[model samples]
Target: MCRGQTAQKSKRAKPYLDAENAEKMGEHLRSDYRDAVDFGGETGLRPGELCGLHANYVDRERGWMWVREVLVARRRVIRSFPKDEDVRAVPLTPKAIEILDRQLKGRNLTHGCGLEHTDGTECASALVFLSKRGRPMRPDGVGACVRLASKKAEVPAVSLYATRRGFATRAAEGGLDVFALADVMGHGDIRQSREYVQQTPTVRARVIAALGQAPPLTVIHGAAGASLGADRDQQPPSETGIEANENAC
Candidate 1:
């Protein structure tokens, strides 16, 4: 077991669930926070950003969600800045949009969490995920719920941060480059975003397969192949059924 200084010097812990396992974990969670779990798995938003999500920032028609602010759990405050202090837009999959749609129908936008915009207009947009008392959710509460659900689902135990890692992994699998993944993750440094992506066996296999030394047999018998080699090289155009066009430039 790594302890003390050794633990500190070891690779930073990065836990994540693949897409399928993440869905299974969501299945075991109670209805109260189930959507939150699903959303996290899909969007890869930070816990504070998830808790701070507002209806106004969601553009269902465009299929995008803007990360404008975060719920500062420790301070018990709503701040108009993400962890990197940079606002970013994250694309939504159809499944993610579905989760948001359901939450939109059930939430009372006139009340609940509120945020003060920078333009001197104090908007009282309701948070997407809220507590029983209609306040912003804390990270501790969210993490506890994730652990309970993971145990029930019989999947690997993963923290809420794992959802972010999962999203990064899924994105990488879908062919997103490191720089683009960094932007979507709201990461200030590309290196931090690179840490989120995990290489899977399937990806490794593909890389190896691309190095094959020979082409498929079908290619050798095809038009291009038939035109190549011995007799064909000495054959006249007429014998090969190849004709020259008089109109050619």
Candidate 2:
């Protein structure tokens, strides 16, 4: 008897919150960080990039923000560039603009670090998102808030990275190509951006519908043992003709 073959289980991608769930999560998030979480969903920015955003980099007139730096959460230090040195510009949505305007209102261009450093000295920087104490927001701290909010919202617990992935998934569903997605996400490789796009039922339906709309293919056969060829312009043969041709082959 032949041995039975086992099918391998496919690994599931990380969970991501859509716009509706994001709003639900926001309702449960601390007011102080609600805008930060919302902005993350809008821009698809990594938590570090979001934390290191500066007033100088925001081009409000053009509706774009440059990802020039990242705050290292563990060391509480600011790096000049983001991961993979993938500095890129993210276009601001109307919602993102509103969030920025609110955060920047009456805020100084620069300030001392809100959190105490290892040396017991404050790091001076101009960061966009800050804690209630006016300190730089850490990725882990934002993640903690997201987890708590997810629980309260009765959604799957997600990290800050989920916000970024959610952004990518939304963009993909909106017909944005992987190349553009990669650029906006500050991904050095297109494959990294591709991974963020989930193949949801809607996307799969779109693909199937698109393929279904294509013109029907016509098969042409030549001499004996000839390979089959498609001629889209050629009309299909009648059933009787098709049977006759098969018998001839």
Candidate 3:
């Protein structure tokens, strides 16, 4: 060890937005934006992935959504693929589907990108979520909205990413396997998914309960009467190292 060097500190996991806090935040959010927050938490989608979701990618009947692209929030550019280039199919819960249905209602599925391009070019875009002005929803805008809502709701301020983390934490506490969680969350590395499953009081209690249900150990002897005549206060032959000599003789 170097005498002048300082030990590196481990990074702390970000606080997750549980259901109670989410409901509080929702109260202060606009109706449309509230749906976005709920949808994000329900599906565990990244902010870019959520903003880039399009009508064509949703399979309402099949209850799945294909994640194939991402919206770079700062630049407002739509990329052809999501982070880590991991295209995936995320299963939607009934609540998630309902949110999507509401957003899709009365919208032009064939409409092009609502935001005006700098080059005056209109590209094909049927984004599932948009601002009240009909422009594409940016990740930064989502974060700002979440922050403002949290402040108004008198809850700890959290970014849009907290919704994704919240989903992961809930899944972990619900006994979802880490490997499956990774796939569902579109994580390229399984270790990233394991961070959400780290030891907590709920997890510890589950472990204790499982241990209590384990079968009791049984001790088998060569014969039922093997030690019947032995001195009750004496140590067993095995413990005294006498059994080895008897077996050798």
Best by TM-score: 3
Which parts of model 3 have CA positions greater than 4 angstroms off? 1-10, 82-85, 114-125, 206-249
Listed in order, each prediction's TM-score against the native is 0.71, 0.72, 0.73
RMSD of each: 25.0, 22.1, 25.1
Give the clashing pairs for model 2: 114-135
Candidates sorted by TM-score, best first: 3, 2, 1
lDDT tens digits, residues 7-68, model 1? Answer: 32336544576677677888877564777877887898987788878888888899998998
lDDT of 3 by residue, 118-202 (tens): 3444656588887665656656556667777787887767777888888988888788899889989988888888887864336
Candidate 2 wrong stretches, greater than 4 Å: 1-12, 82-85, 110-125, 196-198, 207-249
Of the two candidates 1 and 2, the one with more favorable lDDT, higher being better, is: 2
lDDT, candidates in the order shown: 0.65, 0.67, 0.69
Best candidate according to lDDT:
3
**What tens-digit string does per-residue lDDT give for candidate 2 at 1-249?**
321111111233445667877888899887767889889999998877888777778898999998866765544556665254677899999999999998889977666534333444455646778666566665666676677777788766677777887888889878788899999998877777776554644555566568885432421111111111222123233232011111110
Candidate 3: worst-modelled 10 consecutive residues by lDDT: 219-228
Is candidate 1 or 3 superior in TM-score? 3
Give per-residue lDDT, candidate 2, residue 52.
Answer: 70
